[model samples]
Target: MRIKYSIPIVFFVALVIIEKENNIISRVSDKLALKQTPQTPVQSSRSANTLPKRNVSVTSQGKLSSAFMLMKRRLEDYSDYQPAAAVTTRRKNILLLATTRTGSSFVGEFFNQQGDNMFYLFEPLWHVEKMLTLETGGTNATAAAKAYRDVLQKLFLCDFSLLESFIDPLPVDHVTASLFRRGSSSSLCGEAVCSPFVKGVFERYHCGNRRCGPLNLTMASETCLEKEHRAIKSVRVRQLEMLRPLAEDPRLDVKFIQLVRDPRAVLASRMVAFAAKYKNWKQWATDTDVPIDDDEVKKLKSNCNSIRMSAEMGLRRPEWLRGRYMLVRYEDVARFPMRKAAEMYKFTGIPFTPQVKAWILKSTQASKEAGGIYSTQKNSTEQVEKWRFKLPFKIAQVVQKVCGPTLKLFGYKFVTSEEMLTDKSISLIEDIL
Candidate 1:
């Protein structure tokens, strides 16, 4: 009975061994078949190129392990995929270079009213003049020039923090106060991203309080980097050479708008405004006894020379300017604000939208009704010729003599003695004043 049971068990063990050997052979045969299979060109080359190189040892592993390795390789390839081409967005940087009282304030105000997307700074470099005092020559002037350019570079990059080293809002002078007010209203300091310090000062100042208090309103570098358009209006810079470095920087997309006004008109406007402030021309004149005309004539000559020098530089560097520089006359802008504004927007890469048009119309209308204190708000054809009448016939002749070359270059025609007398009858500057 023991021998019969042992014989049955041996047969059962042999059968189990045979079944196990058969299963091993079947798996080996399947793997060999897969290895020997012909692959299409795409599967053999393209897939191999895209996928990470497989280890021969990994391929020799069991099917489950090999399948998992293939999946992981595919995911790695997908994560590493990058397009050969890319699209990038570049911001527009604009510099408005002009002399003081040349209607730059009005132009800057127009840009400022464009709402959030536009970052407009009015006379940002005025602080340099205030700190260094342009009247002092030598090292102070040299230092101020360098500082001016440095400030411009930082401002263009949207790094307002650099300004704090030189500018302080607590002093409450016109320059400081204006900068503080402008900074407070800037869309760059919107509630979402504004620092606690800026928010506090803004709130306090908005409540009709003049004091700015202790405020740290410098913008983060990233905030400035994200701005769509950045613009600076400067009367402090007299030469284009001062800005050439900024224009040539490959990283910055810079365009320049050179604002020019008739020298006679500018002189007349300056004298009248000065006379009004001091109650007489003597207070502001270099020589108190000198007639207003003589004092203004000397100024006109100096101012015209500076303007001509800048214009001559532009002429010499025509290729450098190309599409980068635009010349806009105050007369043209004043006479046809909407039309000129559209052209300006096009040059600066700013869209001439309905909103901008509406603002222009509203602002120009208000300016006509209520002339501003420092600058005229009136945007009318009559505004241009008002200077002809405001300057006395003798003074106008003197200005034409001193500034004739610049006047001709800018296309400003001289008014005949008869025309000057006729315009003097209808002059509105005195009336408006």
Candidate 2:
């Protein structure tokens, strides 16, 4: 599966020679049925950089080059999703609603790897969180919520003009190199949208790995229109109610999937991933004696309350959320990725492509944390129990005391002591009804 992308090849004449190689993806996609097949990784017949060039008949100015069109043809290898092509090709929006340090990034891969059909954005709200200011209290939060929803709704509809306003050092002529995490999205990285001429990208293993010119929001919008599905993953929006308007929009068909993790694990993870913000938690970690009544703990209490309340709202299935809400636990996905991923796709009413399946197989079994805290690749099974050994018994007890109901609601079990916490033999996840 690890074919070095820099395979020596001559691009003279743009001679197209990709038919054999293109079939590899389709064949691989066909092999991944719902049953637990052998989880062996599939290798490509040739490197992507060497795709044979052909002249595409341009019906409209929107039609891109042979390299890009041929790529779209190859990417249309929806092996597992063929029967649902009509359903899958519809314009659908997905909002991965979650809080930080909750493995939302990892879960996002489930949609991000849907190949060419998916237009995925990672935390577009990061721009809003930075450039906007509001009142210093609850009023500030309400404004921020509406602002986030406004931007997200526009983004879901393939409109980026509004997002440009929030971006500092704004893009000129709708083009800028300043899109936060632009590399995280495939549609933005693809040749058709990455730049006027992006045939060079075919040289890489995937669009995500390709180096593209400055992002032109004009091209991004056009590219998004060509995509069948658009997904945005953000931990910025904490409450389900904040996005009720988006879910109800007549112009958008949106689904909400809320990702939550055990609060003790979330606190343990935040201390490492967001070191600056969690300095107090880190200090408490070293001392192994947390101030259960401290403001920091109270903040944790508020976070737990918000998360639990949000989960309750989704679970309640309010009229606005009928057939549109799904609440997922990070622990369950880490433990059983394939099963959980299938359920997620089912909820979203999309097909699970081979690209996603292959990614999960390769990524979940990683030997090390590749990209540090934000990395999606990890030994997922090991990650599930990692916080148990890291979180001090006393500190964990404090979180348990404060987030007790939250943990119970999410099916996380409490441990009595360090011995019980560190014991890998016992399971800490209770099955939720």
Candidate 3:
């Protein structure tokens, strides 16, 4: 009887120990399930589906956590995140459009000096214009227009391969050549801030002779992708309508700054430059392949008409141009360099940092003292009205008659012959209008 009782007691003790072990395992499983549940309340049914289910075991939780951490690391390493407003979230593409001798080069230089991160191309379309000249007789206007747009699209995308077809060797001392000589290290890298691809390309191609040699197309194209802003200036696109397709393209984000100068000043400057080119009117006509009857006045009139038409397009401010287009007067920029520059920065979504301000002050000061063929370094205010004195009274009359309407449209006052002859400052002309 004692042996039988001892056997039953041992069996009962084993059963109790087994029950406690099972309870402990269930408690641990409950704790783990709570740990695996997301902390935030599910905001949507879709998000609920993404969350771990209620029955996720400890083994599955470990795997899920590992996968989540991997994804987090990948996201952190990814580039191309912009903290700025959504409008500026995309890469910036700027187009500066103007007629010849409109201070566009000066403006282009402003963008070029925006430190690194800006790939500024000065007159990239000049090659297109050269091609058009060669094919003038046989080229279809519509086809030529399409070709121009196509090349621009590729350039804006930073594909420099297309440039090889037209890239002629620039003079050693040329401004563009000098820029290329700096190599990808200085221009594209921007003081060691660049993408891995840009760095690799620079390291590979930035050697001795290759430095100033023709641009490394692969390096340039890659660097362009890494840059924050890409800007191109061109005087070739005369009509604003020509850019409508580019502006409307959903894939591209293009901003247009139409630079305008006083029509009278433009005519006076062109006439002087044109007169200097040839010995006499007949020679000028012959060399240009124009009829002898096509005098300077007629040429001036044609230029004025083209400019006026371009300006008129902007004046209309059609549905497409509401926010993408900006008009900048050359005189205003010359007179109020800092203020106008700040305004331009605002329009282009570029930050007006201290570096930019310093550049503006230095550039304008230099320009004031050293006027070049394309730009003046004289006093800004004086430059605005210089045309009044430089142009003869009779010549001024012809320009005023031809461009007066367009001038008035841009808020330039019509100067009288008497005022011009007496060299008197007309009060209306003193204002922008």
Candidate 4:
């Protein structure tokens, strides 16, 4: 064995043993603990590789001793050498589960307004639904639950490559400019996911304040990965039970926020907001007899049934949920936007950032509704009671009869007549049931 090469190896092994004998690992552990910060994990491997210079003050006769001491110092530097994985950063995954017209868009802003720390997606699953429905001719979540779960799991882990195929199947490279509601995600609109408007290049694709070419999924993925938390809001998932796989996945820490609204109010809002689909219900509002067995009416009942079942499962606190499911009523949120938003952030284990708080303060108190039905900004306090007036007694009665269990379960008071329905002072909602 060459003395020069073999000696360092021997010294390395001896220094490691000495480190163990002297419990240097414990000291390094304590040192690492001191370096920890609230927003960061233990230092990276690069930090481990950072070694201090050693003083080599020894005579030629003691050259071996000098080499041994230098080796000992090097070993001591790496005494508790922990890889970055030793203290990984745990990420928060949030899914805002709701049916259409449940104030999901409005509530979703709580995360969207969280600035750069949050990766918010607004109804990305709508694309998946479109693609799947086109292929299978099935619109129900039951047929598409597994597909939704798989895509969602990947998305929560910051992968959007699979989404490209669903976004534009015709494209050879599998990427599309049309990401559903692409403008809604603040992160996607920022410089990271989108480039600033170039006069001739990307004049068509506008993202609120900026214009960009086809939104690059690669950039969006990078932005998503950089964020400490990811949140997706969708009105597609019919029931919370369908999301068990996501909550139970070891790779993710997921929290489900099920936003429910008074079905009567939801009916009233949907009637005006989605006028075409609710035409039959609108006609029924004029005192026409409601066909309880009609597909639309059955759908209302089905939505109610799905909501109730999910609520029951969530309230049960199953082991899989592990205190991660939150059921929030839209009326409660509209009544107390800040309070509800704060509660949601707490439940999801994220900070209620001041920027989010400020946005809610300005948004809920806007003088006039902006962006019409799809708008996030609104006069929430007044908006909450508007449904009471818009929904006629006949339609309210039908909703009450069909969604009675859901109404009772969610603490919405039932009204008997048109006068009662329109009465300004009557409170249709009671304390959360």
Q: In what order do the candidates fall by TM-score, top score first?
A: 4, 2, 1, 3
Specify the poorest-scoring 10-residue window by lDDT in model 1: 38-47
Model 3: lDDT of residue 388: 70
Per-model TM against the reference: 0.65, 0.75, 0.64, 0.77
lDDT of 2 by residue, 103-180 (tens): 898999899889988999988998788876522433356678788999998999899987999887788899776788
- Could you give candidate 1's per-residue lDDT for residues 1-433 as a string of tens digits? 9998999999999999999999799568545543532212111221234323322222221122322222223222321212232212357788888986688877766676666676767676766676566346522434666688888888888776556555644333211222433442344345534433433343323312233333234443455566688888888776666667787788787878788888767777777666664344434333344353554445556567566555644533344554566667787787678887776776666766677778778766664557554643555566667766556666566666666556554555565575644454543121100
Predictions in order: lDDT: 0.58, 0.73, 0.58, 0.73
RMSD of every candidate to native, in Å, equals: 26.9, 20.5, 23.7, 20.2
- Model 3 residue 288 lDDT score: 44
TM-score preference between candidates 1 and 2, better one: 2
The local distance difference test score of model 4 is: 0.73
Q: Kindly list the per-residue Cα lDDT of model 4 for residues 99-124, writing each as its tens digit.
A: 99999999999999998788999998
List candidate 3 segments past 4 Å from native. 1-87, 137-144, 168-211, 272-296, 367-371, 375-378, 421-424, 427-433
Q: Which is better, 2 or 4, measured by TM-score?
A: 4
Where is the poorest 10-residue window by lDDT in model 3? 53-62
TM-score of 4: 0.77
